[model samples]
Target chain A: MNDLAFRLRDARATLSAVAVFVALFALYTLNHPAGFSANVVQTAANKGVLLAFVAVGQTFVVLTAGIDLSVGAVFILANCLASVVVTGSPGAVALGVAAVLGTGLACGLANGALVVYGRLQPIVATIASGAIYFGLALALRPEPGGDVDSTLADAVTGQLAFGVPASAVVLLAVMLLVWVPFRRSLIGRAVYAVGSAEASAYLSGLPIRRARLLAYASAGLFSAMGGLMLAFFTYSGEASASNASTYTLDSIAAIVIGGVSLFGGAGSAVGAVFGALIFRTINDLLFVFDLDPLWQPLFLGLVLLGAVSLGSARLLRLKNRLELFGS
Target chain B: MTVPTTPVAPAPASPPMSAPARRRFDPAVATAFGCIVALLLLGSLYSTRFLSPDYLLQQLQVGSFLALVATGLMVVVLLGQIDLSVPWIVTVGGMMATAAAGHGPLGAALAIPFGVLCGVAFGLFNGLGVAYLRVPSMIFTLGVDAVAQGLMVLKTGGSAPQDMATPLMRDLATGRALGPVPNAVWVWLLVGTATSFLLSRTTYGRAVYAVGNREAAAYLSGVRTRRVTLAAFALSGGLSALSGALLAGYSGKAYQGMGDGYLLPAIAAVVLGGTSILGGRGTYLGTTAGVILITLLQSILSVVQMPDAGRQVIYGAVILAMLLLYGRGAKIGA
Candidate 1:
């Protein structure tokens, strides 16, 4: 294939994910009673951004062919910590933000350590660490009532110029600062190499350990950002088990929809962000169509199944049955 | 310059076949049993009643439910896959059984099987996706779990179901017909024996292990790998549901979220028993020991009046520590 054609082929999954998101989001907006208003867009953006952040975090770990079940727990931990610490003074709020972020980083690093050094599988290690993080969150906010800095929360959640959501802007800034840099960095490339073929990557003398550690650490940072956004939106913190589990599952779903291969070594945070947006839109579409709220889970489940099935269609093209086992 | 090629040695007519080495007992099972004993001793320190036959039997009864769920999970794990749908499938089993029981005599009599059948159906769906479509079992089962949760929610309208367990179900879950042994324990023993027989003696069971170790190699060796995968998942679904049904009986009614607590504990039990999460290398006996260990630990925690947070922390810590101790060498390439 020609270079341009090769690039396009490489980008096909992400492009398709974007297209799907646009189509669903358009359908969602058009069916709404208040058609295409900034208020509606802002509300949607605010909701979508939370999952988008978590999905971005998930993208990093997944890119390294590792899963982080503890992302949601870390998010909750950050939220709980933010609620308590992000209150006092402007300086104190800044410190609180740093503390929350640091905690997330530490959690991510801890998970990386367990997986890399302890040699535990990502799924089980995260499950165990997730429990620990959640336990800490529960201890921090046993009753679920804590405060955030109102001015900051309002400002961040509020709209900016041209009715663009501030949260969306922050997400963009994050993408530019975190995602772009990582994508261009040596360790980032190593992450992809490791995910694609760990044995080969190791043989090639790639920094597999550092790459994985960075991937996990970035996941933690992004999840913390998500948690911080959640606190801003809610103005309080809750160590809700359902919320934690739901977000973790939803992030994985979003990544799949965004065209990231769960098998790893492909896709992007951009795709994951769109996937998160697409998922949020699906939920809102039900609201616009006057479906019973009870139908939401069923609808979401069906959409996920359909999306996953579509992704698996390529398996039918495999000539050798052996190809199906490893991939 | 003349290049010299090395002469090829003649191949041996046939290499002598050596008898298979006798399998040794797994140290992990021993470790799990050791933990169980330690937990029992710790419990006895807190309360003299811990050693009583009634209390120990009660613990056994509770542990039986977990054992059943773990049995199914172990099968799937043996196939190198996982079923995250256990929690919701367990709920489906309980709800469907209880719902059926509210109908008539026939419905009451068939309630348990009905629940198990529903579980099997869901399991088959999971199997179809993983085995045929080749969707990753983790993600596929997770989606199935969501779908199950949605269906149950729709069925119950977000409230507790009205149907109570039938007398037979309750008797199966709680009653001790054979002196001092809970009926649940009896049920578990029966299931365990059947599973042990299947794993050790049946071609299909051997196929499950072979497929789990290397699906490609197993397929090359004439194993119906896809069928094995499907069957394992179905078994997992059915057993998880059976556990749910028994739990509903223990509680006298099925409720929403009744199965939410089983998924992790089931996986943990299987792994603690030395079933490699990667699949193909575990025993039914190890899982039994692991279940008992977990139950005793839980009992001890409750006895000490640890808060939920502390329990969670300790539970996670113990799992992590145990994993680090024995689960360190099996590394994922990624």
Candidate 2:
């Protein structure tokens, strides 16, 4: 029994979601034999890819027991800037992708500067940065239209072997890339340490500010990656409306549901990937069912509420068991 | 943790506290004085309408609502937790008021308490979640916001409610006393004064600061830790509800996102007014000053015809600067 639990994933919050995904996928296959076909798989992969990236970014911030509430704005800002530079030309497309990522790094750097050197709390610091970024995105585009090279779009949204989706493969690659630093690097350990206890970390003289700066910056870099995928999904960028605003909450929800504590410390890259996959699974299932847009938020909220409640319940049961045996 | 001055943390803690918290008064007064004087100069220099009595009164009028909501948000921040659900709570409060008004003013007046009670109910919910469940306040409040938004959507059907407040309800928002001042201003004074008194002169206030400083220590010292947390959230929720009702009474038409704009400013005002974002080191008086400073700044910027986008940047920057200025104590709880 213990071995089975060991074999299972660590982030317990996501289990029920995984089960739900399985159920939904089962339901979809039953309802439509074609739903499990290649086209649907690609569509689902393409749709969830950007959000998965954003959730990945959110994971980094959340690991430090902080939230990047500005992820949506950061995503929008990057894509919108990229839209300005990238049109029909392939060179323009390459340049645009670079611009989008650079935009994300710059925004992340600004957040890092305020949070580290400026001595601001992560929550307020991000909210303020988010506000500024939103304004900048608005000022840059004022309207919601941008050009993307069709070829570039095709490349990103294309596929790999065994009918595996391109977006899915890229997402996996990104996850693998991020895990390298998080699992093996000094910065990774520092992140968990700071998130666990800032005071203790400070006492340990672990360059706490630098660690936090890197965490926030890396989170921003992922936001850029998410934005690139997001632009490709629609093949456009626009700042006229609160574009991708939903992803802010969605990304955080994914992180939380992935079994990361909001209080920071104790999470895994696998957990975040699973979390994003779970969230996207729901969206994909909903699309398969042809549910109305209004239901999306309500459903998302309910699923998240269930996942978090399950976590609390599990902890409570564990405490009760310990108490019973101890007595 | 190098201090720019003599390192004070190493000193025995009890002795420094009673060196008269009053001794720290001069800088505060000077800062408030400087802010006021700067506003006056800017107002006079920038526009022909600045010194006009009507313009000043109009700005004061608008500031009153923000002041009321910020006052409520300040109460919770005092306890080292935040209330992200405030805007929607106010919206719901307004909705409840309008719903109650179908019967009469007596009915609408009854709704005021109900609105406040609803807020308290949510606050208690927040307190329980944060204190007992050991969940982060940020996620919990964000959830509360979603639930409240859901409730509003269910109640109003994605549009402003058809109901308006009864006459008595409207009077609280719009009713004026003596000259140009509105009734909301009077209510603000009442709430601000009462809160200031409670925070300064009451045992509950001290307990709040104690818990905020360190919950475990406060719990060990025999404070009813759970009750204190609940009361803090309850007060925040109730105040937000009252302000919401006051808003509904004044505006007569409650829209969905009206409370949205108040969220950031409410937090910003408390921080700007020299309250630590981390709790146990701020006063209602400072928050009150912050409310004034922020409202004045917004009004001034608008009067100067700054673009809406530019104003957001300036607002964010100013708030960031203020947080850096006075934030002290242990890091704030999530």
Candidate 3:
């Protein structure tokens, strides 16, 4: 019974965010009058799929108390490479997928190399690396215009059985895969230990370096996947696609909103996925309201700020309870 | 090179080396400096134009603004915070100064001050959130950056400044004084010198360093950590604005994204100059070298006709190698 309660309490962050999503959707429905339309649902599903994927990538890195600023840049680089290498042939699409995944892996390796052996702080190292990657992407295409396989895009992103978005299925699959290890795997628990206390983790003989390197690598790969899906949605190769650069922050906000600790050692992948969904709903609601695009960033930042402080406040209250109870 | 200082708990009792030996070479500083030198040397060898003093001086002049802004970043880094708002602030400041020059010389004066104050106000806002409000500087500065960037875009209407107001401004950028030394070079020298002196000699400087090294300790020592932090952000904002104003005078105009180019380089210079990103240790000298090195490399590459992306790849790789070599030095300095 106690274990059940603990598990239930652990899930509160996801539940709360979902509740917010429902409330916001309600408000939007009242205002739009034509709400619950299939198109709106499909758009939300598509947006949520892309955002959820990116947030999942961020989850691993943030779990280890580091960040990957280069994710957006890497996302762009993968697309650029794909646009250059991919073509009309089925083999070309296959190669394109391999090439993009390879690009992501290589970029992650570069970041991991610097961060691990170079003893570089993840944020600074990734920022510089991001600039270089972005520079390369710009140099490669400079301007935006390249075609991805429409068939491939449609197949992956189009509706599934019962008219559910295919991309939504992919996102759900990722969440399922993540949840298993996150609960039972020692490596996953090691990540939490490392984030909560680095030196302690090291002293305990964990492969802190390997874990960190792999975490960033996973982040890179997942971010690339996100970019692939994003490209499918846009259907055009844009070297300047990541120029908006808010995608990185947006992913992070999604994670935080879902109840992940910024200081690390807490949270779930599913929580992050749910966070992205709520955020997507809020953003869609804003569009329904005809609010300025600029307001999205401001609103996202404010919500993230509130979510984080609230999360911290809850932790503090728990700490107080533990102190009083002498747990 | 591990000092074996308590990483927050008891360690195996082992005296690794003499305390002085542990003290001399901070790995991070050494690595960053090594990267700078290696890049400088490689740049010099790769391009025939690098041998020419005339070619070299041109890069130095162009590099001054980056160095100036970086020196301010160095101070902030000492406090273990990052400021990403410099680019737009510089661009806006330059734009304001250029536009105000039409108001006459007096207007130029007003505009320049206004630019600095604009940055200062933003910095104070940053200080308020990061210091008093206990917010993460990253989120606060980035948010501030977005707000500033939006205002700049709104102000410029996504176009370049139509009127730069004077030939004097361009002359300031291009004119040479004593033996081919550019005016911008002189400006860089003064800023570097003054900053170095202020950081090294003054009580405030020491206090800043102390606060950065250990805020709790500094406060326990009654060093008014809040004021020092506020001042650090203020200085960062002010210097960024000053650099922007000068660039405006040099470029004879300001574009919407003019300061964008300088942002990364400014941080790069500070980091390469041996300033620990985690803060508490830095010097104007390292920042000076950093600016010079980046300028030299970029100029040499331009002469060699290497694409910017290629240069960047080499640059990133080089910086990484250097960090690997000297990261230990950085932690000690931190």
Model 1 chain B poorest ten-residue lDDT run: B14-23
| Candidate 2 accuracy as TM-score | 0.88
DockQ of all models, two decimals each: 0.64, 0.34, 0.28
Candidate 3: residue pairs that collide = B26-B329, B27-B326, B27-B328, B27-B329, B28-B326, B28-B327, B28-B329, B28-B330, B78-B280
Candidate 3 Cα errors over 4 Å, as ranges: A8-14, A25-34, A85-92, A135-143, A241-244, A274-286, A292-327, B1-47, B99-106, B157-172, B176-179, B328-334
The fnat scores of all predictions, in order, read 0.60, 0.24, 0.20
What CAPRI class is candidate 1? Answer: medium
User: Which regions of candidate 2 deviate over 4 angstroms?
Assistant: A1-34, A158-163, A199-205, A240-245, A280-299, A314-327, B1-19, B22-33, B104-106, B158-161, B328-334
Q: How high is the DockQ of candidate 3?
A: 0.28
Q: Model 3 — TM-score against the truth?
A: 0.85
Cα deviation at B276, candidate 2, in Å, is: 2.2
Candidate 1 residue runs with Cα over 4 Å from true position? B1-22, B158-162, B330-334
Candidate 2 or 1, higher DockQ: 1
lDDT of 2 by residue, B1-334 (tens): 7658855666653445553565367344347546756787878887767778777666666677788788877767877788777877778777776777666557766877777778778777777776666556666776776677766776777555556766766777777765678777777888889888887779888888887787767777888876887788778777877777777777886667667778777887777666666677677777777777788888887878888678767767766655565542334232
Candidate 1 backbone collisions, by pair = none
**Each candidate's TM vs. the true structure?**
0.95, 0.88, 0.85
Best model number under lDDT: 1
User: Model 2 clash pairs?
Assistant: none
